[model samples]
Target: MTTNQAVSVAVADRRPLPHLLVFPFPAQGHLLPLLHLSTHLATRFAFSITVIITPKNLPLIQPFLSSSSQIHPLVLPLPPSSSLPSGAEHIRTLPDGTPSAALIHALSSLRPSILRWAKSQSNPPSALISDFFLGWCVNLAADLQISHVSFFSVSALLAAILHPLFLSLPPPSSTPVSVSPSLPSFPFPHLPSVFRRYVAGNPDWDFTRESFLSNSLSSAAIFDTFDFFDSHYLSHLRSSSYASGRLFAVGPIPPAVPESDNSNIFPYLDSCPPNSVVYICFGSQFTTEPALAAAISAGLESSGVRFVWAVGTAAPEEFNGKGKVVKGWVPQRAVLEHVAVAAFVTHCGWNSVLEGLVAGVLLLAWPMEADQFVNAKLLVEDAGVAVRICEGGPGKVPEAAELGRLIGEAVEEGSWPALRLKAAEMARKAKEAVAEGGSSFLAMEEMVKLLKQATTED
Candidate 1:
């Protein structure tokens, strides 16, 4: 070959693999999904991923680190500040009733540290991919001259519903927004608690609101959802002026957790009959109020349904000898995958909701805060796989007797057969998405292709 040919080969071989600097908001619900995405970007598409974290969150990413070589950690200590308790690196560790805005405000201090780290690197990241909670990263990406993308841990249905608000439009009118003729629209009164609590010009409310609004200006946004849930919602957002043809739905990805020695727990799980167990958990952050826990136990006992409750705080002592009450870690995905678990009592956090969907278990949704309220709506009205028990947010305890009647009816043999079919069908659709030539598989390809393209053009 001529010298010119050799030079061409040398230059082409030196081209860098597209690198993404990912920042996961420090909550299990927020962090785990991004870790799954980071692993997907690395293993599935061969992109180099550098995830940002404070010191305490390293353990959370440990499972992913041991599995993939392409993803690296950029740990920066929080600069000394009295705003948050020391060693409170993630939201799950934050004291209950701490203002939601406090952590967001505290985290913004890391912007300078991240900026310095990126500058010191030899090959700058191709783009910055951050959780929607850290919407301010759009500016950080601008400073580094990299494309900015926000990853939403919520559903596309919620994203489309909130698009107007994200663009600074008026609150959705009390009339239900017509999402689809066949499915129920989340009327203004039924909208998420976060949106309902909006107080214009209030300092704390404005701060949180702007964090959400800043995401609309991102060059691109990713949703942890798939077309099977709502193609119309996905299409609407893609066509919206804010998204401008840059929205990717590559999800229903399962959370990563440690391997099971759940054999100890399975004796209880094993003793239950097929589709006879009700599995209850309220996500990572929300501690169950003691009275509410007792009320739930009362209801479960009244129904005479065998159950497994993963109450993070304290389990009700009254239900002793009747059910399994776990006060510590339970392998949620593993437990849900079991045949005995027929229904899930959940907070409807997107991650937990997706896990239940994939397991083909019915969701007994009790949305407390954040996007959970909207999630419950989509499951009950749109997806037809869930039944909402009560949703007044946290501290709105329901009457135990009424809750029991609902739970018993929901899981009774041969009840809601059509709903059960939908749940099972959703599970199959989830599997199909990962199969070759599926919608999500194709979307994943396009997302990676575009990310690489953006890197080259920049």
Candidate 2:
């Protein structure tokens, strides 16, 4: 080849990699999926990633950063605000009854610093991808003249229910409308129930709604859900006016948990019989109240089932001989994937639900707040992969006897053989979707292509 042609070829081959700035909502659930996405972008798409996090969540994400040279962690200062406690930068660290507005304001206050940092970057980020809660980033992306992508770490089912189509539905007679078993899917029943019971009472509900609306104005959205499970809801969102931009279902987004990292978390699992223990945990943000915790403790003991419970705080003395209590952060994905774990007693957080589904464990759905209740309904009533523990609203704590009965029923083959079979099938599909050339895999590729095209056009 001629010298001029060789020089041109080298220049074309050495094209600069796209830089993406990712900002998660600063909670464990939010941080995890985005972190996984960052890793995927780095390894799969060869993009440069800078994940922005606050001081408090730095520890949780530090290990991931240390492991990856391609992905960088940028720690931003938690803005000083009287609404939050001193050093309270994370949602999990914030005291109970703290207003959601306070957290939103605190997060919003960081915008100037974020913009300043962006301006100081040697090669400005080609795009800004943020958790849907950080709606301010959408505007910032516009100001920076780069592409914006909103990441919703939620199910498409939950998304459809929360969409304007359902939100605009007429109210039921009851103040907090109860979800009847016979409620039809068309026209979206039980939405008022969701609003009155979960959204209306939540201090930050309005803030969350506004954030979602703002995020809809972005270039596109990414959901941590798979096609087979969420195709119906995905179609609904695409047809509806709520989703303005392209919607991508590129998930069952499992975090990369190294086997060496959490080996010590569940040493007792070695002794337990295969698929014999029920693993229980709420997400990072939802602390099980004392009354419910006592009920669950009593229930687990009475059922005579081998169990591993991650209660966040110390387990009660009652559990000392009967079962294991994981006080600190256990490697949840690791625990779920363990051979000794038969079932998952969960709070129905999307991440936890996806993890349980991926692990092929039957769920004992005990929804705490927000979309969790809706998620539980989908799992139990619609999907048939799970059974509900608490039938009433969030206020109704499961009694010890009821909890025991449910626990026993979950493990009993005679009672739920069909359900168990279906759960196994769902797990298989979840795995397939994320496999090479699978539905989620293709969707992820499409998303990356769109991002690259947008960056090039900009």
Candidate 3:
């Protein structure tokens, strides 16, 4: 038998394998990557996996559950809260696409429910792998006497940047703080919009800030970032948090695309020249303000580059030969992989960054909130694969002339080829990091060993 199979068989031989319980904060960017990672652990290690999901998010987990019986769902009804809009279990489904603060407040209510369920169980899970946003899971797992492995949906770079902030009392002020000698200090205002909004004495705000701080005390931490893309940051985080000594960098876990999928699937990409089309998408949670949207459309139109704009709303006037403007979703992974796609204009969300990196598509970054500004720094300054075209929220608009120039110049012959080449090199290392015997692969194996050890002691 092959090595992975042999490992799986040996793991399965230990009947009633150590159960892994997962809890994802309800957001598209956070949910999907953890699900993908959970599925990988199940298939490769033959471990039983149970996901803690709300009634509304159940549908999203169905396909992953259907394919693998090893993975199961533990549905928990979302307790009613005025803070959350009814039936809105995910940030993507929030009315008018609001950011996740309200949703985070609503999710904090589930802590008691989760605690009760675990306490009643005959076999409490060996480990509770939960989203970084739900840092209270560290305390929850402690209550159940299980390992709480904090799972960061953000880049390792962002997590490293947040470490100092988490330890600081009363959160960060307007001043900048140094995280690593290799990287620039981050001003508090640019850290995360939510952090600046914290009011120390308020219960909800204190709870939220406490949740962010609890990650440091986790039994272990895992980032959905592979070493190739965030090696320096990951190493810095490890050295800083060495007392925990169990940080894992095991991802950018390949997307769930079918292996047999083909380029002929997209006629526009199929027909376009190599390194020709520009791909534009901000994440689902972000909606461009109409004026900003109009400016972007005008810029794309003026640039004269072949492009694909998944604007979601406020579409540009289509010039038939120029490009296609989409109102909804596009298969991002497939689009990035296409030979015709030269560059991506993106929000620098961790998931989108990995997609662009793995495809070797250079970035034209428009980072808004959360850890995006820091992620933009990694791409623009540290890695040299992206150019920062714009920064700040939807209201922050740039001159159409400047925006068009940056977009046009991203693929222009000057420095574009070098950026693309470096991206390609990172992409190669990224794929290798997840393959057998790679840095990510070994880290995962070590995590599994720790998980199995947890159960044996039980």
Candidate 4:
């Protein structure tokens, strides 16, 4: 048997495993990271894992399923119709065609279903891991007397910044702002521009109430970031009020661990000479307009960059001649690790950024919403790993010239190779964190122990 197999068998033969119920926030970005973490926990700890997902997202969650019966997929039913806003189905489209407020509410509204699922499980979970934003899970854990911890499905840097804000946003005033349709800008300036836009439009005026909800609700906060990437952020978290000795940092959870080789899938994938292809993909959630997609396609063609763009809803048909579009999903980790993938053009999702860094690939940041813009900023400003597309006319799509010039400059820039080398170094540190004596492994051990103690006290 292979060394990994031997280790797996030994782990299985050990004492009874813990039962873990992992509930991710009901979105693609949230689901994928939590799934990766759940898979790791199941394989390494021999734990029985139940992943809670919304019914709408079950199809996307299904393909990742393993043959191992130890892992279970549980779908939380949609809530009562009355709880939903009017024309909720159409809410995927805002009045001006952006993502709608109703969609956000619908995602957050899954608390009742998740709580019911947890309480109703036949084999009660030994521990609970939930998304940090899902504050209601803490309440459910308390009500059910189950040990619970929050999962921040992003980087150590992002989570560290967010943790303090969770506490910081709570108001100091006598009167509270009402949660309403009109969202106001976030209290903090550090939030990404897109998040700023959303908050500006959709006021949770309920910030103080939500902050209290979080403090009272979660037993601990867990981050999906490794220790090496952002020591300062992690340290900040440990010392803050958001600090619960309950925080856990366990990650570098690439889509595939040890990478099961699939050379036949993309035969050209390995054959391409080293550092030739620019790997382009926004995370799974981003869906853009035909105009933007076409513009990006024209740019890739103009740049003469051999690329594999993992086509999602945002990928346009116009690029058929310019590059290969692997519809559905592509093994991102494998692509990044492939020698030919010299650079990554991305939406700057935390997981994507981490994986690219882990693979030591240079980056092209095209942030959409949420913390992505800030992540792009950090990569360019803090990490020195990427460059942004140049701004264009107000409504004009990126011209072939703009795309060509940036890609050419980035490729020829002597700094890119240096940055790639640095990114690889970061990746090495990430791997070290999960090694047997690594910081992430030890953190998990400590977290598991804390959960056992907390549950016992409860």
Superposed by TM-score, candidate 1 places the C-alpha of residue 280 at a distance from the truth, in angstroms, of 1.1
Give the TM-score of each candidate: 0.88, 0.87, 0.91, 0.78
Better of 3 and 4 by TM-score: 3
Give lDDT for model 3.
0.79
Residues 150-253 of candidate 2 have per-residue lDDT tens digits of 89898776665554533453454444442222232422233423343335444455655566557657788899998887776677667664447488888898
**Candidate 2 total steric clashes:** 0
TM-score leaderboard ranking: 3, 1, 2, 4
Candidate 1 local lDDT, 416-441, one digit each (tens): 88889999999999877766787777
Which candidate model has the greater lDDT, 2 or 4?
A: 2
* Per-residue error (Å), model 1, residue 95: 3.4
lDDT of 4 by residue, 1-458 (tens): 64356456756887334677787665656767777777766665556788876555666556456534567887665554432544333223234434333343455556666667766756577677876555556665666677778788765556554443444444333443222222212323336332233343243324323532463346677776777766655666566545365567777664533434433336766666677777778776656567877777778778876678776565554343435666665678878888777788888888888787778888888776677755776677666777776432235466677887677565554745767677777778878887778888888777767755644554
Give the local distance difference test score of model 2. Answer: 0.74
Error of 2 at 180 (Å): 17
Separately for all candidates shown, the number of backbone clashes (residues 3 or more apart, or on different chains) is 0, 0, 0, 6
Q: Give the number of the best model, judged by lDDT.
A: 3
Q: Which has the higher TM-score value, candidate number 1 or candidate number 4?
A: 1
- For TM-score, candidate 2 versus 4, the one ahead is 2
Worst 10 residues of 2 by lDDT: 179-188
| Collision count of model 3 | 0
Q: All models: lDDT?
A: 0.79, 0.74, 0.79, 0.63
